[model samples]
Target: MKKIYSLLLLVVSCASFGQTIYTENMGTPTGTTLIPAYSTGTAPATFQNSSPIAYSGTADVRITSVSSGYTAASGGGNVLINAIAEYFQIDGINTSAYTSSGLQLSFGINTPTAVTNLLTVEVSTNGTTWTPVTYTPTGIGWTLATISSGIPSSTTLSIRFTSTTASQFRLDDIKVFNFDPSCTLALGTPTAACDAITFGLDTYTVTIPYTGGTSGAYTFTPSSGTVGGDNPATVPVGNIVVSGVTEGTGFTLHITKGSCTYDANAVAAIDCKPANALPFEDKFPYTVGSALGANQTWANANTGDSILAIAGSLSYTGVTSTGNSVSFVGTGAECQTPFTATTSADSGLYARFLINVTDYGTIADASTTYFATLTDGNPSNHKGRLFIKKSGTQYQLGLDAASTTTNFASTLFNVGDVVCVVLGYDFAGNTLKAWFNPTLATLTDATTPDLTSTPTTAITTLGGFLLRQDSATLTPTITVDELKITTTIAGLLGVSQNSAIAGLKIYPNPVSGGTLFIETAANAEKTITVYDVLGKQVLNTTTADSAVNVSSLHTGVYIVNITEEGKTASRKLVIK
Candidate 1:
């Protein structure tokens, strides 16, 4: 019983290897004969009438007749006869569909049980050369035989049967089967981008292509990074989404379904996170031919050159704003200024600039016309921008970051409109805030900001600030003036106190000489403190008399703080 069970298992295993590519039977011949047989090298099999032997059909393929080739019939109704030293061929069989498990050419043959070496079978790709195939016969009525060795790798193939010794042999029911397992797999492209503080979720969807194998659960494995949502997720028939992760590089998808494993191509990307700080400002107050004032200068951040000549189009326009303002024009033209910290402890920073769009000719919108930008050395590493654009008949203001843009407001200005733009950078929080068209004089008191964006990449350092119009034909004329960089909200908004300090008065407010007089209601001893525009305390002194000397102070705006009898008052002081 055990031997019978083992034999049954072998027969079942052989029967399971049935992915048939081609089949031929001698029934119902066509063309010039009753049966159609594929031929090669001038030898083709023919249909013969059933008589003595039939292996389940009334017709058999005959290679040659007794009168033509001097061979005896094998007496099988559905069989091919091969005489000694003569061969018959069956061509045009496609072997490309054969899988890695290999292929087998199967047929039923009837020959004398004693005739062990009756015939030899060979397979070929081109027909001139051939490889011999090993045949195993079951030795029963209409026995099943298979030739599985030396099968050509080519997609198109031919097989020949040749008789060796003088023996009657016939073939019928020719079939070819391949042992091909299912489930071939592949993956689609993944998603990538920079990190944003507000929206940090990056998503990628990969597809799996599979068919007709084991029906079971599928699993995915990443090469370098972890899968964002789920690990070893069930295989989706369509696609799967990988979400909720920071910037990653060199990610590859590996899929497994049952016994098959597939590895996709590796994908690489950049998700940067750098730090940033602020409290630096540029007013562009210089003469037409003078070098950019003191520590401030113009540079081409994109091209790495000093573009500070007085003869070029990016020089000071000599249009005085309290003194003068700078102008920029032409395509891809830009001017940048370096940042200097106003105080030693300054970390976060904000900047306010006045922009007057004088003439914009034939310019459509701000999609390509990047008028102002903040960067860290490389222009490609853009932190933020104030984009002036025209939408239809109305002009608009667009606040932009590395990955997203926010259209904040619409203005009434046609071509010539002066607008105030304020930008704040929070280095610790990785966020950018902006205010548009607010009065610069009272900006510190403005409660609401227009727009805000959180970036995924870190804005590590304030390398420079830039101004340009990236258009050639659309020559938009712009004038920039009254720029201020500061760390405090009061400094950024130009906060000033104009009222007298409780019956105390400072006469000749714009003190041009070396001496200025101070008067108090009760002639009390008072301590005076002066702060620069950047909120830096430059002078602190106590005075008992009515007069104070201010001879050494520079020509600029200063905030004066007066304290007397536990009372403190603040006011703006100017020196000329």
Candidate 2:
């Protein structure tokens, strides 16, 4: 009995000898979402909420390294990564009571086997100044490691982990404490999206799912929107909602349970832009070989095979070819064009674009490839996607509300054929409709659509358009140009009929100042009026010369409406 009591006393003495002041076992991480920091557990131990780790250096994530069943993970990283965990104060620690020689730090580590690869730990009171304390590992397996060499001379502590060599490390059970009398240490994401706008209040309600936290009825508060929902509960688990959300803004949610709180990963509210009023068109009017997306209307254009504005344009039956067009050779990065946003109440929205398939690329068996989609502000949420599959040497076009395997067209169209494709969405009906090369009389909402499809899941919002360049196997040299999007079919047909005499070309588009050249088939007398994206008139002038003095216009996207006699041609212009 005396021997057992002595062992227990020795263990207690060793733990308290280090004066375990702060310890983080690290909170249990769930799901595949990479954890940004240890924010799940209680305060002082777990750095969260008020204490956030600047996990910006590299891919610092909660990894599922093997644990003998204690908790699931440790902070993990790859080679040559530097990360900083911000400091916070514990309630009872007195900095004056401890000295640099008496302080100790301990943690569990599992590192890569490279002999030169090492995990260097640095301590900092303020984030700027740092002191290195080395904890070299002897093996690749999980090892409880401790070191007490160099310590920061501050009450609170922050840590920076760096590895200069190509190695990996798992950090867990971290402790920063002392040797005299004080006590010892211990330790511890949400994807938020729009739910719906409650009918009565007419405000957006958001739902966020979290991976780490004590499971209970928690009241969630948004950093921007208010908390409200129908079939209400004071605290909601699984389902929580927020109202009055603003679009095109940075958004974050705070979860509260009793006195404890957790902050979810930051996300933005999808821009629920108003439905387009004017006819929005992009003729790919930039200089040939000029890559899309920098100071241009397209977003993420430089990502894929470089969404470059290649020479030439797609000529449609009624739409005259003017500027250069964009093509998809295979798949690389997805690109977005912010044209207009459609609300849930909107029933009709239409888009028309010219497509010409030069040749088909490698496609998986029985699988179709999507080239275009109607997306929300967060371009990932595709509302209605346009798909195409190869049927022999020819290609078949398809449409879906949100499905990849949506049916393809029965009529096989040949490659090298410039075809006008019109895709539309009816939110109230939850239907995706399309028409191929329709004349003015045939292009009415009342007329039966050429292709019709219903979505498997209901779509609520539509804010922009996205071009798919995502798959390597789904390769096809598809050229697209003369794109136009609007909420009504009248908006699609509102442009004046294309006549040879009235057909005009604007170039070295992305007018580089000097003089903006507008070339016509006749070079006839014309009056030009330019309007910005918001339908605000920026430039208006009557010029008989094909070249108008557009040097006065600032750099932006503008719609140049050139009127020749009674006929008018509206084209998109990007002033560089």
* Highest lDDT model number: 2
Candidate 1 lDDT, 1-576, residue by residue in tens: 000000000011122144445555443221222122322111212322222211222123443321111111122234444456655566666778555346767676776556475678887787768878887665634566766656665665777777775556766656666643454332333344333321122333222232222345667665544444322334333343343333423355555655444444324332232222233333332334442311113434332112222221122222113334565554533555545433224455677777766666566664434577776655556677766655554466667665335545545555566677777777766767787766555555344777777767757765556676465454366767756556666766433212224577887789998676777786677777676665445676777787878787899987676655434455678999
RMSD of 2: 16.7
- Badly placed stretches (over 4 Å) of model 2 are 1-277, 301-304, 362-367, 495-576
lDDT score for residue 309 of model 2: 70
Q: Residues 168-281, candidate 2: write the lDDT tens digits.
A: 566666556665432211111222333331111122335542222233455656677876542112222233445566533445555444433333322422433222222466
How many clashes in candidate 2? 12
Give Cα-based local distance difference scores for all models.
0.51, 0.58
Clash totals for all models, in order?
17, 12
